[model samples]
Target: MPLDLPSDSDTATLAETFRLLGDPTRLRILFFCLEAPRSVGDIAESLQLSQSLVSHHLRLLRGARLVRGNRLAKQIFYELSDKHVSGMLADMAHHVREDD
Candidate 1:
């Protein structure tokens, strides 16, 4: 049975967030950002993904407000949007590791 959710629209919104999280690439990207704020180039290099691909996903993540970027001189560094998101990811990681 479905647990009580605020409304259909709210469920849909939450589902959309999960949909974004469902992709392995996106998960990797998000987890990588947990380490520290990262540049697009740095994310690509570390994840071994194309810069274009990383940028594309970053655009989606930015749109969803899951990540925020800061301009440091000419480069933009991205980190989790806030401590709430960061803590959620950390707790989730711990849960997954414990489950294993």
Candidate 2:
């Protein structure tokens, strides 16, 4: 369930969003998904994870509404749920950069 917050709750949402991204496995999944909608098998292969393990992580991501899936034939392809994830990642990278 979504937390009930006052009118100004952008930070709450952002915090929750980042919390979901805190896991390294989840971070890799998000980056891979950002590249293209991919099948569980593809993610497993690329990340060197078993299909079952990848599926488990995907389930968590789906539960958080951070990823979306599309079925093609007997396979399901996954992608980011919205542009917010991409935008947040980009903004984070920009702000977290070190001085030259």
**TM-scores, all models, native as reference:** 0.88, 0.77
lDDT of 1 by residue, 36-73 (tens): 99998899999999999999999988888888899998
> How much is 73 displaced in model 1, in angstroms?
1.6
Among these predictions, the greatest lDDT belongs to: 1
What count of clashes does model 2 give? 0
- Candidate with best TM-score: 1
**What lDDT tens digits, residue by residue, belong to model 2 across residues 1-100?**
8878655477776677778799888888888888799999999999988899899989988987899999999999999986878877767666779565
lDDT of each: 0.87, 0.86
Q: Local error of candidate 2 at 87, Å?
A: 1.8
In candidate 2, which residue pairs clash?
Answer: none
Give candidate 1's whole-model lDDT: 0.87
Worst 10-residue stretch by lDDT in candidate 2? 5-14
